[model samples]
Target chain A: MTENNYIYAPSEHPADKFRCKVPMKGTRQLFVIDGGVQGTAAPLSIKFDEGNCSDEILQVIGVRTSSGPKELSSESSFSFGQNSQGRLILCSHTFAEDPFITKEKIKISLAPNSSVDIVLMQNEHNDAEHISEFEIDIQRDASLRMVFLTLHGGKISNNIKVNLNGENASCDLNGLYIVDGKQQVRNLVSMNHKDPHCYSSQLFKGILDDASVASFSGLIHVWPDAQKTQAYQENHNLLLTKEAKVYSEPQLEIYADDVKCSHGATNGRLDENELFYLRSRGIPKKEAQLLQQQAFAYAVLDKISSEELKERMVSLTEQRLRGEFSKCKNCCKNCC
Target chain B: MLNIKDLHASIGEKEILKGINLQVKPGEIHAIMGPNGSGKSTLSSVLAGRDTYTVTSGEIEFEGKNILELSPEERSIAGIFLGFQYPIEIPGVTNVNFMRTAVNEHRKAKGLEPLNAAAFLKIMREKMEVVEMNPSFSSRGVNVGFSGGEKKRNEIFQMAMLEPKLAILDETDSGLDVDALRIVATGVNKLKRPDNATIVITHYQRLLDYIVPDIVHILYNGQIIKTAGKELALEVEKRGYDWLING
Candidate 1:
């Protein structure tokens, strides 16, 4: 809506544009470009330092792709790129965004033997929308691991789509979301297997309280020629308040006979038997409940690769459990 | 000392104990013998303040103070102990923590200082030796996966730690083997003092052979049909419960 002024060039290819200069703001050292490339084929390399952007640390968000590969800032609102080999690794970092504002799409095109790692973070205090559209072209013997973690935000939604283009390629999608105090969150993910011998695995975990609502819907499609493909999906939710609700759907649509696929969803409250057992031993009810909730949220938080980020997330999760989000109604997601 | 006068109790709409009267003084032991449904266990439950039973009409006094109105935990702090007929299995709550909390709670209610962790552990070790129970067992959850004999032994161990003024053993010998019964009885005997009392409830007279009672009372149809010295227990065991019920 701001005049579509993102830089788009026709001189470079997706495989040969690693050093293209992009402008940046704030106190971070990394600068990300938002425009697309139209004609040339080249690989892109991302470098972060103190000259272009400020000397402070930087995290990126919003990724897209055009005719050539694109490099994005760690905290941008939108970005897009593509490669031939379809190999990607999105490294993890912190970012800031608004919850009420609508943002652009982040697209990626992977060429043969090409890999991408996009690590975007959201630690802002305003109302903003973060929407990323990923188009993956997985070639033979190539793989992808897209790890996403929503540590903080007022309202958050992630839409991911991956296509298996070649035989014997695989993609693993893992996500963790913690919401509390009237916060609403939605996660929509879809994977399409167009060729044979491709595998896809999806796992999503969440905790909701203070009248919050969370929904996760995952879909997997296997074409007729996608024989022998193994696909598995799971979604688990924990509701701390009586008014909190979680709606999860794990779907699988296969058109081949030699494929094995399974999907499961679980939604429930804390264990009452375990609570009574602790209380009978003189442990106050509240402390026992906190310990149980912390143990329940451990598996999801452990997926984070950064030790500092993971520790922060665990502390935030505890705060969320104790209704900390209501205190920082206007601050960023990291407040909880 | 513990005293009960015209104590009547019921479970739901069904009356289980009818006008039960008894008294136990310090330095003494009393056994209540009855057939099935004769209210032997019901009396212990009522004395322990278990919510499942309603006392229709009764007056219970412990150490010259009324005790029927107190809660289960309050009664426990008042020096009343009930060794459950069927001990409950509480998972994830270790026996050591349970006993430590109980002891400190009782002590605090009595205007006494609480024991630190080290002192508490030392006291627990000394008490555990009374029942010949393994020191390592206290680290596991309360009565979780314990054998029948072990459950009975743990009950006595708890009694030893709390040092209740009036300890009630509710059918403590029902499931114990001979060796376990002797050990459990010895633990109860060792805990007794000139200023404390014990009430033993059992359906069979065999337990009385190990834990000698100063008096024996037969409960039939919710009422104590007869009262006598320790000789009554041997007489009833020789004949049967019918001798007392019929007369």
Candidate 2:
């Protein structure tokens, strides 16, 4: 519940328009920060460089509204204590309403043998617009696992960059998005392997319907010194309607021949055999589709460790897939 | 229980089953034996309503109703089952869950009450013994990590659970060992009743030795050329399909 623990540091991203003259402070491990404004909100930046503890954990949860045209910006950098752990759980929800925008950046520094996990969710109003930029750093013997989910939004775009600066550094980035209508989502990612023996894997998937559009551009770069590095990247998109569109590109550049790296991208319709199999098993066509889709999303969702959060996301995901969430604001009107 | 007349089927303009006719009354076990590429699997697929094949011209009747217009699930609800030659391996859905869902759907279609958890588990246990399936396999994903024999047994286990009025085993013996074949054949034999019918499609008579089909038909080039008693199977075993296709 603490909302004033972070400060506005010198950031390379476009600075927020409103810079507070007085500094605000609170506890480090637990805090709340809100950003993104459309109808009415003062531009602000977030920074957290204090709270030097060995086991600092940050859990992020999000909520949203669209009363008027407003914009929100958030920026923060984290450096974990040695042999400690950190977690970021991002959840943002918005009902159907007017438009809002967001500019966000996050950085994490893991000490040797330390690990971090980040779970992010962005579900916005259909009329809302959002854009985000992120930068992350992982140090020696440190690992990072990130799960980013975008369920609903209008004209959403994300730019992300990660730097593995130490040996034995590992990173896993997984994402899932379900979009429909005129909505559009785009993601661009850059992963850097700076030292030897680093490992990175990125898996992203999306389901688009009703003329919606999605794009993914991700690259994994292995430097010369990053020999013995192993990197894998993949992007898969399912177009539920003929009018829906998707563009995916997964790239890998290895300067060191000793490293193993691979990339793949596929955009197509659902598997006909799988659908028929379920249908023949006595499930109606629509129910069979939902089952298959949930299974498809499971490839990425299973990576999450929190049961409560996973359950919530799964419920929301089913509603979105059923075309029941975006239309209802207060309660599920489709059931009625 | 099932009747097919002038059944002509094709895949992408290539005809497979051309002007074939067959009939199977309740309580009878009919075996259709044929060599490779003789439309054996296609017949099963067509019966199962697989979209890969087009029934250019045919009439399929099941239980006094026209089944050609029925969707796959509708046909399943009407009590028609096809034990696939190569069973599909679904990685996430479990065997128990799959069977429960199927059984409930059939019940729902027939205006019967859905079985409660306890009742369903009891029936599952009883049916598992028919196929000699280990109880531990109920939780594993459908056909995932199962050996060839285990998969065949699972198919039969599913059949036992559903208790379809008409069951067609499509080459269910292709990749099975002697013991596995015996178990599967025994399961099928024990499930037979005067109210239900079975169609065993195989390339070899080895299976017929166990199930002992009441009627054996030699299918060649998309049509049933000969129909006889169980002795027909023994004759085909001595002389391969070449005699049937050539004569």
Candidate 3:
């Protein structure tokens, strides 16, 4: 099967290539399937047809090691049967000194009475460009929880579409992006409720600094027959500099008379009164600012159900805010 | 051990606290009573080095060091504290973490080792009891969703934790119920020491009845027009500020 072609031995690759140091407990690490394939496209598929699947987490790491400016494409599909429960983590990293471009298309499906949690972490060097598109579907009595964390990248775009095709389905989507140094990030999300008694929520937050730019556009659609549908969406952004910019738009469309929907978007700066209060308590200006930024990010990080993973992500986020990961520590050439 | 001489301050074009002189010594409590818009809050803000008010011409010396050039945090590290009229609410920052960070900063300035988690928690628990605060408040956000009395008690709790040499309470009696006022005053009195001083600024004499200041000053029209003993507070309470302002 094509799945076997994408599975490799973890021992063949070194662990230092990945920027995050958090160890995923009880997780099966999937190595880079197309390690040496330069400027080529790879297609992979994984299926879970068995019922009552185990709680083991599947972790996939996509790494690009070639030192030339090349383009790569990847397409993946994941499906789960009825009554199955699972978790998936997708991470992308680039160790090359030159600029690398990547395009990814992923699709996920959940059958009746199934549940799943997915986490996508994008942490690449400054010379990397990434674009990811996700299409997800849920059947009757199914549920999904997803989080996207963008720590560092030059130009990143994420487009997500979710459809509730059966009754009693629910989904929670969340994202956090911290960008600086001429970086750009864009996120577009569309949630569709087609049946009765379905629910959805979306919350995304971003912090931009040093001439960076970010944009968020989210849409929630409820069909005519989708009675008792409950949906909510919100986007908040904090700009740290005059040059930093953000554009946010939240839209909602409801054809059903018995549905509830709400959307809100805001752009603001750090509270000056709060900063003065903290400073009056003897905390330095820089340290107080870092604390505020960390507090701003905790809302999204608190959604992770795994305690160990949450702690690790918290530390990683703190390091990123402190500008520790902005420099290329592993690359032989000091490009950054 | 605090001194202010010829202090003149302003916000934008309007001037406040014009040419004021005051002296406070160790082991003493001084009360500054003034009407609204008489610069009571502005004086407190200036003492704590808030950037909103510009010190046009003044000199503030604490323990023989000029403090007007210092930042808020620098002044705080130098043992100066100002209890705000309205405590700010900071979401997502637990009281325990905030106190720990502030206490550690103060300790670091003194070349002392930081307290361990257990030691810090023990100290926090002991100080929290001074305000009769419940243990749950330690893990909640700083002043988030707290009642007016609870916010005042939290200010006192912070004062007890920092142990500053010079404490300035700006209108600590406003919006406080009788019970909360007693608790907060008691907490402040408990933290008093022979080597420190306090400046309690209030509009009414109800708080003075509990704290019992040693000296009282009447501030009017951006100046301290009269200075007297504790009996002056009773006089002002009996008669309105009109008698003192006119004479």
Q: Estimate the TM-score of every prediction.
A: 0.55, 0.88, 0.92
Model 3 lDDT per residue over A44-128, tens place: 5666654757677777766766643378777888787788887878777776656878887889999998888888788888888
Candidate 1: Cα lDDT at B2: 85
* lDDT (Cα, 0-100) at A98 in candidate 1: 19
Worst 10 residues of 3 chain A by lDDT: A327-336
TM-score of chain A of each: 0.66, 0.81, 0.89
Model 2, position A15: C-alpha lDDT score: 44
Model 1 regions more than 4 Å off: A1-336
| Global CA lDDT computed for model 2 | 0.78
RMSD (Å) of each candidate, 1 decimal: 11.5, 6.4, 3.4
Candidate 2's displacement at residue B196, Å, is: 1.3
lDDT score of residue A282 within candidate 1? 32
Q: How well does candidate 3 match the true structure in TM-score terms?
A: 0.92
Interface RMSD of candidate 1, in Å, is: 5.7
Instruction: Please report the interface RMSD of model 2 to 1 decimal.
Output: 1.6
Model 3 stretches astray by more than 4 angstroms: A1-22, A33-42, A49-53, A67-69, A326-336
lDDT, candidate 1, B1-247, per-residue tens = 7889999999999999999999899989999998898998889878877667899998999999998888666777788888887777665456886777677777887788989999999999999999999999989777889999999999899889888888899999989999999999999989989999899999888899989999999998899999999999999889988867776
Per DockQ, the best of the predicted structures is: 3
List the lowest-lDDT window of 10 residues for candidate 2 chain B. B89-98
TM-scores for chain B, listed for all candidates: 0.98, 0.98, 0.99
